[model samples]
Target: MSFKKRGPFVSLQLMSRWKNLVGLNVSIGGFVGKYPHCFEIFTHPFRRNLCCKITQKLKEVIVEEENVIRECEIDAVKRVKKLLLMSKNRVLRVHALRLIRKELGLPEDFRDSVLAKYSLDFKLVDLETLELVDDDDDDDDESLGVAKVEEWREVEYREKWLSEFEMNYAFPINLPTGFKIEKGFREELKNWQRVAYVKPYERKDMSRGVERFEKRVVAIIHELLSLTVEKMVEVERLAHFRKDLGIEVNVREVLLKHPWIFYVSTKGSTQTVFLREAYSKGCLIDPNPVYNVRRKMLELVLLKNRHSKELSRTGDETHEEKSDVVISSHDDWEGERDGDWVLPILMKSD
Candidate 1:
């Protein structure tokens, strides 16, 4: 998409120069060939060199996603406000927010479009930090302290008729399929779930018990995932907000400890932590417009070969086929591994 803004197409040589920067191990032309549905490789009309441009379908999806994000500015503001409220200092680094902007459904120019437009609600402490502006008219400060998970706990307690002992201070845990439940695992999981800790939005004291501190970290990660559009986030991206959010422990270890509450997937280059309860059969239970559009793009990428074959059959090829470049099959791609993408759980026996 960035290449599209520069011109109709970018030379493969130019793209190859920065392939490592984009984390692509394969040559730029080879990478572009793998996803024919999203990109088209062609001979440059004047330069006579190999070049690539995003396909019309992908361009439309990008525009549609941008439109959807713009339409959801109000909700984005609420998400930002909630994030600010959940932080330990009631302030978040601009760089940290930028890392997870797409996950939070913020627009590309959110600094101007969302935060600056709603200046009364958000304040720029400096060029790099953002803080929420306090509303003096609102006397109910306690209401602001309630985290999103507390609402779920309330629902489990009242509507589902779950006892406080079972639901209170507990997160909704959905263990993955085929998870081996060893003889004392259930009892241990139950005890861990029942362990109380300070909520993500609440204040914390200086007490440093290991169990309490770990549980608090779990809650912080849980709330962070809940705020995302897909109920997942890159583990390294979460580390960017560690100082602002008070996540002092190793983020990946904390995620690995709570198997039921979080699932760490080593599918891509980065490790992503998925909130287990938010997904059913690998699909989000509650997907938003931005997620839907992004999913469409993913679907397009997944069906690249089929789309290319269809275009060939219908005589609808968009680019010339005279080039000597050999596009490899999807299986030849570097990261195309078979079987389940989820990493195996490494549980320690008590």
Candidate 2:
């Protein structure tokens, strides 16, 4: 993914290292041959083998990618800022943030670019925590500030419905279709959903209704998942943050209780909990800016694939006119031979 890691070119002799991973099925020369417009093979700088270099067109594509990241930076900032504001003390541990910083679209030196740049909005205290500044007088940057308490409520026009205790965030549950539900389970969830408890942003009050405790558990998990790039995270990874997030021992049971908001996929060896709202038909529905940038990264193609498409569109004439390559026969290639002897760095004893 680093544009300059290979120094704008790679040796054909080393293509095998990347072929399978990059989905290539041709020899390095054939690969470069297929995309003569996008890639060229030249003698290696110091070695006898040849290397493939990206054409000017590919450089232009990389430039466009940089522009997209710049355009999406503001949206990404608000996303990460909202996550910090949602924490219990409006602060989260530095280590915890680092774990998901890539998923949060933070650059490696976020302390300077993101945290320092948003100094009025965020601060790294004691080099150990990221805390949100509590000033809320300005509406201009509210998106980067603690969201209004009322906004946490899942439903609007709450004054007309339910009591003061039920005035808490309405944790809506929309189960996947055809999911069987027993009457007792439905009844318990109905009470639990209506039960009011501490939101992820508020101070915890242990003294609460029986159902309120369960609601808080769900809220904690909800906020945690919301912080992810895909609004989903590995169940195993989530377990590590249990103590930090103030989760109880019955985390697994709590996750099962809300199949609507959270969907656990056993696709991998471990379970991954996905926020249903962020996905549709197994694909991310509204991908975050971080993920969008990754998607753009994926759009990049090896020179071979790009060249093949160009030839198909313009015919062999274009390639004949453009390429001056004279590929050598495989037998002439100086690869490892049966009689070749290995050299030892240390001298043999007499």
Per-prediction TM-score, please?
Answer: 0.85, 0.60
lDDT (tens digit, per residue) of candidate 2 on 228-313: 66676667667755655667556777787678888877652456787776666755776655565444434443233543544332
Q: Report the poorest 10 consecutive residues by lDDT, candidate 2.
A: 341-350
- Across residues 1-350, which tens digit of lDDT does each residue of candidate 1 receive? 23223245555665566667655666666666777777676654434455566766777887888899899888788778878887877899998999889889897688878888898889998988999888857554456567768989998877889899888788887887799889999898899888878778776673368898888888888888888887888888899988888888898888887788888888645588888888777678888887788887777767645647544221223542222354333222221122112111111110
Error of 2 at 293 (Å): 4.3
Candidate 2 displacement at residue 161 in angstroms? 8.2
Model 2 residue 232 CA deviation in Å: 2.5
Best by lDDT: 1
Q: Positional deviation of 314 in candidate 1, in angstroms?
A: 13
TM-score of 2: 0.60
